[model samples]
Target: MVSKHVKRNYRIVRYVLYKETLLNTREHVWSFLGAFCGIGLLATCQGVWQDERLTVLLIGSFGASSVLVFGAIQSPYAQPRNLIGGHVLSAVIGVACQQLLGADTWYAAAFAVALAIIGMQYSKTVHPPGGATALIAVIGGPQIVAMGWWYVLMPVLVGALVLLVVALVFNNLTADRAYPTSGRFTRIIRRRQQGGRGE
Candidate 1:
């Protein structure tokens, strides 16, 4: 009695949510711990270390990074190289665009993100947070720019390092979890060299 389209939709939903769904309480504990640590550190730093107000973007980055890194631990997307390189590259590109593009607002924002993504791809360090880094740079006020590249090193790099360090410890604590993939791509390259067909 089921229509074909309805059957297809049901299958899609099941597949999408099936294995990835967190039915186990242990899974929730690990995932939440990663996310909480990242955000908590950032939040604590806001008032004590720096007077800057926490923006939605920074908060979102902290939360999303945790999810990407811990929640999907096996994914190449969350690897340490991708996490740090992507952000650093984007930060540099953003500063360069701000200097060269002359604050055209929308143009700078758009181009910085696009360019940063392209750069990341070429560098083989594609991470989701890099986009935000670029956007931050383009729209960042004079004070941010005045920080003169040190801003990238201080808050961005330092924050990411702290989050990553915490994830490394917490993720590896459980027998089932592994933190910051060691060298997946290297293994793949070795396989390819040995004639393992991959497309």
Candidate 2:
């Protein structure tokens, strides 16, 4: 009685709608607050110390990092090690590429991004935002180039650590939410659960 194509389309629509309803109000609130506080702190510090005309505190890649660190809290890429290692390594590679190949060149930008990806992958800290970090170093104008190696410490490392701390606080506020879904934190969570059950 029903057409196969119609049934297939209805199934696809239902699947899409189901996925959309997955994130509830509490998850949304936590994600928003976490990102806001993390980025806000970085921006406030940058504004206080750096010249108003220059964008020093927050890098473009960090925006992408916030999305994963806050929104997709469960993703492996959002883990603390990945977040820090990826950005730091990428920044180092990017600065090296810029210094060796000259900034503002397409070849340097491409090579930096490519090498960053390889480094992240081999290092087992594959965060997607690291690509942007590498590219920014290649063409972030004079200010970023000026910072050079210090860029790895300030914007990349500091920003990531702030986000990780925010995520730890915010995500753990709800009993159902867990941050740093692996490593030491995961073991601690398991111990707590076992202890609660008197195991």
Q: In model 2, what is the error at residue 120, expressed in angstroms?
A: 0.5
lDDT of candidate 1 over 30-116, digit per residue (tens): 988877877787777665654432222242355666778878878887889888888888888888887788555688888989999
Q: Model 2 misses residue 74 by how many Å?
A: 0.9
- Give the Cα lDDT of each candidate: 0.74, 0.86
> What TM-score does prediction 1 earn?
0.78
Candidate 1, clashing residue pairs?
A: none
What lDDT does model 1 reach?
Answer: 0.74
Per-residue lDDT value at 191 in model 1: 55
Q: In candidate 1, how many Å is residue 178 off?
A: 0.3
